[model samples]
Target: MRKIAASLAVLVATTTPASAQNAVDWFGVDGLEFASPATSFRFTDLDLRDPHVFLPITIAPFPTICFDFTDNAIPTTTVSFNGNIQASYNSDSSPADGFLDASSLLWFRPLAQDGRVARVDNGGADCLAPAPTSGCAPSATAVATAYAYASFAAGTCLSSLPGTQGSPAYAPAIASPAGSCFVTAPKTFVFDNNGTPLTLIDAQIAASFNGVPATALSNGLLRGFLRESDANQIVISDPALPGGSVTLAGPAGRRQRQLFHAQRQGHAPGRERLVVLFQLQRVPGDLHRPLSAFGDHVRFTEDTR
Candidate 1:
């Protein structure tokens, strides 16, 4: 009788938990559901300042419709409002079963002609003419916007793994910047991961003010990087130049360049966390300007964080 009781106890301990409601239930809340949730992130974004203030070339460098003078000049650009962001989490007795969704709106304006820096008259300008005020206006601006979205998920299935090893992340619908600068209707970038990890594949910016394709921009004004690890840092590999890394910090810290790495470890049972850190390049005076070199432009290295 004693032996039987002990056996029964063991069976109950193992099966009872499985029989009860699953404690690992994780539900995915759609972006629509979070339309009103209080956003909880910092926006010390310098990109929002006057585009010329963060100039890669010189101070008060007049804005131009075309970047004919130097490569570091700020292009007249703007990004519209932020779009809906949604995140969902789920946990099953499986190897992979989680997802993340995020979306937003962004826009840009590139100067192609002179007088573009100065305010224009009531009459619009053309985008191509050296003084293109006639044919579409040389200082003319192009506007493009579209609903963009992304999704991510993880689960036990072969395709549930998180990373680029599986099907590539969904591509963003490309938009062309007008020959000048233009704004589009509010758009959103939606991210969904049905049941696998979603990886960002690419990002691009155009060189010309014309409404050229995104491929052309990839070679000119675009720079991007992949989320190496949750270390809160990532390396940007600009197709036009060499690759570099970025790190975020609390207050004042030496900016670490080139030398960096990310370390991460966690499981599906709880929230995932990542931190980034770096040592600043010790210099005499502040590195207000970057060293002279093709990829050495410090503007690119300016810590936006």
Candidate 2:
């Protein structure tokens, strides 16, 4: 149906793939462990990128690592590569099942310091360092070729359905940035329960994503909000992947952020939301908006289609 197609549309990009027989679904993860000593961690990822990652961390605001795996280039801060990533697919289950299944496990061998990926940045304050001489920053388009992938989607599940709940999720802080700036595109995501959208344009903040809180009057960074929605989840089952189940719970170790949808009679209440991404950035010109106190800095803007 169009609903399932729309939900699946959120996962548009395909990077680290399985095979022709299966459709590759992108996902994010945390709690990676080592296959060897404490210095080397290894697991498998049927990833959307080149089986690599940009961990959520910052060393003097230089957060990302740019070591080229193809050339075998190494950063002084990183160790030698002694890790592995192999895809083990089951005929009954696909990679998407393992990705969303709480018990199903897909892993990786971290190509970072001490054989570990960087820590999770749930608050989203971490800034990445400039690209090293050896390589460039891990980007969206380049994930198709170079490597390093994290999945984010913009979609809404039916509010009360047993399947297709909180999906197209902003899975934790496995996020990408525009250059050194954190990924600050607000409208890229839209979630709801077949409801309407609200508007909040020119929302402001401080220096960063977790900068000073957005007040009615003033703040630092400015943003544009497309929509805002309440949180809910449900067990999602896909007909394409029969015998498989998913929920798109983002990374938090054992503490999964559930996106469950409650069974309602008809429509949700007025206050209930249809949300989008929360972004932060600077604007060029100042506009005649009501919240003129800090629009030029880093505020928000929203529009509906």
Candidate 3:
């Protein structure tokens, strides 16, 4: 009987699928969007005209293992395509941890040529180990790591959770406007290489603003957005605003708005380019530190084309 029981245990453990092993029923937020040099708001050297970027995000109730479940039990809603799932966490009923996790799954991979969801299995480098050289290889540890990330991300977004949301030194929301803010900086660059008429291929913005003082004013009314229509809204005042301006990038997300234009640099339209800028402002007098002076501008531009 002991032998039979041991055999049964082995069978059960081995037969249990990876997805089922990690299943802990939960909810999260997600988003998807088109990212391209043409529509990129971030800085880059490429001139993206018809570039494309697929952004998907996930927000879990708690940190969780980052693995794809084989079961079809998961159901989700499209929060927004602008890659602003964190904003959805804020405006929606979900706990506001300003990041994405397994629960809050956002799909970043672009769709297939036929416009179907691009199916890439979650067997690559996750929150756990490095991506496999081959395809994704599921592991118990990897799933657990994904779960941890989900939990931490959810905690980071929750306003009610102390030391989790917008308060204090290490807090993302309190430290930097871009920290808790999740908006895809998409930009389009038009260049005139001394009237050579050349356009680059793509762009990206990697930013981190730190050491920002979180006073009382930076709290209450400082959460308001500076819309394009706002009197003090920063305009595309650059002498090189692209003539083929798009009316609006995408729908103004719940807590997000479209702000400015991107420009390429050169003696006429040189090799490098400048990315567009978006500002999250404080109500008049609500901030003690000048935003332009407070945080360090840690931004990077990449081409994903």
Candidate 4:
């Protein structure tokens, strides 16, 4: 009788489930916003033939805007906006790469702007004319608000069991031979307040798993958001209502390679490159929704190149 009681007690203890921890809210009540630090302008002076001498041209600053929507208890997503205007003069025909040429003069202009909003003017004087005597009639052209929703294949928890010889783990683990966590859901997007979806041309997220224990991964993860230095891409898809999709493949779409390099130096030897292919589509009249619905596929592979 004593042995039977002991056995029953052990079975109950082993079968009792582990209470799940509260979901880590990377996004707070108010979503986050990322804007360009500053705007820059480049000017060049070209000595034209005789009368057409000392032509002044300006290159506008390239600005990047981003918004994150991790507040929802469901899927997570993000949106990004970026644009630039470049101009240059080719005197020697040696392939002008849009950089400041030694024989050319470059001028820089700084503009104070917000990433959450976009501003443009119509029906204005030609600022680029040979001689401009009046300022252009500036007006607000368009405005938009963007955000993202993401879901991990291994749920929100940071740890998972180690992978087998043929199939490795997708979520990070505490012990040796950690597994990787993939973004199971598509990175959804939403444009709010009668905003044009095309106002945002590109979006991406950079995640780093630097040997930090699973419990601590979500502590300060918000601060790890990617910035301008991560080499982002521009949207090339045709403009459509509600939303559209674009794919970033090959060298043009690569991101956060340096983080993988650092991990290779001393961290776990697990695969570093996690490829997440996103296909974005409009939610149709669901402007209130934080992000549109779409499908995503993830893969763990080596650098083929």
- What's the TM-score of each model vs. the native? 0.16, 0.18, 0.16, 0.17
Q: Which of candidates 2 and 4 reaches a greater TM-score?
A: 2
Name the runs in model 4 displaced over 4 angstroms: 1-84, 88-134, 142-233, 236-249, 255-305
Give per-model CA RMSD: 27.6, 23.3, 26.0, 25.4
* Candidate 2: segments with Cα more than 4 A from true spot: 1-175, 179-189, 192-231, 239-305
Q: Which ten residues in a row have the lowest lDDT in candidate 4?
A: 7-16
Model 3: weakest 10-residue lDDT segment is 5-14
Best prediction by lDDT: 2
Candidate 3 TM-score versus the reference: 0.16
The sequence of per-residue lDDT tens digits that candidate 2 reaches over residues 210-268 is 22221111111222222113222322233422233323231210122211223112333
Q: Tell me the tens digit of each residue's lDDT in model 3 across 1-305.
A: 11111111100001111232212122332212222111001100111111011111236775432221111112253222112212221132222222111111111233122212221111111111111111111112211000011111110111111111111211112222123212122222122211222222222221222223211111110111112232112111111222311112222111122112122112122122222212111111221111122123311122222
Q: Each candidate: what lDDT?
A: 0.17, 0.19, 0.18, 0.18
Distance from true location, Cα of 297 in model 1, Å: 20
**TM-score of candidate 2 relative to the true fold:** 0.18
Residue-level error in angstroms, candidate 4, position 114: 23
Residue-level lDDT for 255 in candidate 4: 26
